[model samples]
Target: MPDCIICHLEITDPNNLFECPNNHPVHKECLIEWLQHSPNCPLCNEPYSLETKSNLKSDLDKREEEKKKSEEDEARKERNNQIKIIAEKIIFLKFLNMIETLIEKKDFEGALDRLNSIDENKLETVKK
Candidate 1:
């Protein structure tokens, strides 16, 4: 029923609760965020135990690694999307040039047939 000193909120989950050596209550999540900025307990300003600091540091490192991997995945997806867009544009341009060549040869029906064969969704994406 004790409130976490870091967040000023009641500790509802015993499993996620942590206490300083002075018995000051804090939420585990709150302590992790706090530890990034400060090493000492917010309420008592006392240094946390070496084991506690080590565990927190390991958790923080894992969080950082996960975040970096997520960012890299997102960047790779964006790059692939850009490549897809470029490839689509190349295909569309080539189709258009082929149609132009047909028009120059007075093959109006061939040009119209080629235009009609295109997917509407591809046309919409190019328009956007």
Candidate 2:
């Protein structure tokens, strides 16, 4: 991230970068080389990474947020699917009613043909 810590060049890559506690970014490899000689910051010579507080609350909060988002997305998908199924059921019922009315008018063959193409589960669902 520190393309040029002194001159400020274009930072094109971040994989080989590390930020000190003061937010001064440096190349990880270069930092390693510098640390071999002194356990201080490259820019200000301040002690770096001396404190290692294992605060996992932020990580837990991030995981919880991701889980909540996933749950919401799943619920939205399920609701959309339910709406689609209900719409299909309504269409199925309308078609079936049309066939029944046709049968009542004594158009037996046409009614039977239409009924044969009806979704059986949709009829059962509407019946319930």
Clash totals for all models, in order? Answer: 0, 0
List, residue by residue over 47-74, the lDDT tens digit for candidate 2. Answer: 6674411222354456557778999999
Segments of candidate 1 deviating more than 4 angstroms: 5-9, 12-24, 34-52
True-structure lDDT of candidate 2 = 0.66
The prediction achieving the highest lDDT against the true structure is 1
Poorest stretch of ten by lDDT in candidate 1: 55-64
Clashing pairs in 2: none
lDDT of candidate 1 over 1-128, digit per residue (tens)? 89999889999998878888898989888888888778898888998888777867888777778878999999999999999888888888898899999999999999999999989998888755
Off by over 4 Å in 2: 1-54, 118-128
State residue 23's C-alpha deviation in candidate 2, in Å. Answer: 31
